[model samples]
Target: MAGIKALISLSFGGAVGLMFLMLGCALPVYDEYWPLFVLFFYVLSPIPYCVSRRVTDDTDATSNACKELAVFLTTGIVVSAFGLPVIFARVHVIAWGACALVVTGNIVIFATILGFFLVFGSSDDFSWQQW
Candidate 1:
């Protein structure tokens, strides 16, 4: 039941984050859809971890290297997600307000992703290994 509730909450957070991203792009004052590109980052953020998990042994206590690399890649993807809006704003590709909204969305979305992992990662019911 707790896991179900957590899943619902994470889903809600993801929706809210996407709402912010859409607003940043669709708002009348912003009128630019370039900020939607951040969605790619959001999607890419988890790939490394998923890949590494498949390549390495979870039961091995010394299997930190692959996991560390995944973490490193995830971090870079997240940072790049945050940085993209700023770069767009600096380059006048998007307004400052749009950048702020995109950044806010990035933070919320990433938090939700992490929350999903924290909440369901270890539970037998949520077998990420099958992903």
Candidate 2:
């Protein structure tokens, strides 16, 4: 159960991380001069993540599951929310493509990290482990 939860959390985290990374790439491609708005989204991108972390407690199964679900839903909303900004910001297609690539890269990285954590975090006997 713990291993499964870790895997799920890792998957979600990776996906959200990728979304933010892509969103970052998109911010630069827009012709509109709203650096602040871009900055706002850039900053807001991590809000849910931070919140989710606070909500999640790996040691507690029930709470962890709840937090995971909350984080997953929140992440989806946050990702979709960016669409409005992209439209309003008047982002170019090329920039959008760049964002996609960045997002892809982030997702890959997130997955890797998540897998690492899943394995490391699952080991019951941490006494044998070394960072």
Clashing pairs in 2: none
Error of 2 at 87 (Å): 6.1
Best by lDDT: 1
Q: Which whole-number lDDT from 0 to 100 does residue 74 have in model 2?
A: 49
| Candidate 2: tens digits of C-alpha lDDT, residues 63-91 | 56656665676466545444544554355
- Model 2 collision count: 0
Candidate 1 per-residue lDDT over residues 1-131, each given as its tens digit:
87678878999999999999999999999999999889999899988977886787664676588889999999999999999999999999999999999999998999999987777667387655555
Runs in model 1 lying further than 4 Å from the true structure: 58-63
Cα lDDT computed for each candidate against the true fold:
0.88, 0.51
TM-score of 1: 0.92
Question: After superposition on all CA atoms, what RMSD does each candidate show versus the true structure?
Answer: 1.6, 8.5
Which segments of model 2 are wrong by more than 4 Å? 1-66, 73-90, 127-131
Which numbered prediction scores highest in TM-score against the true structure? 1
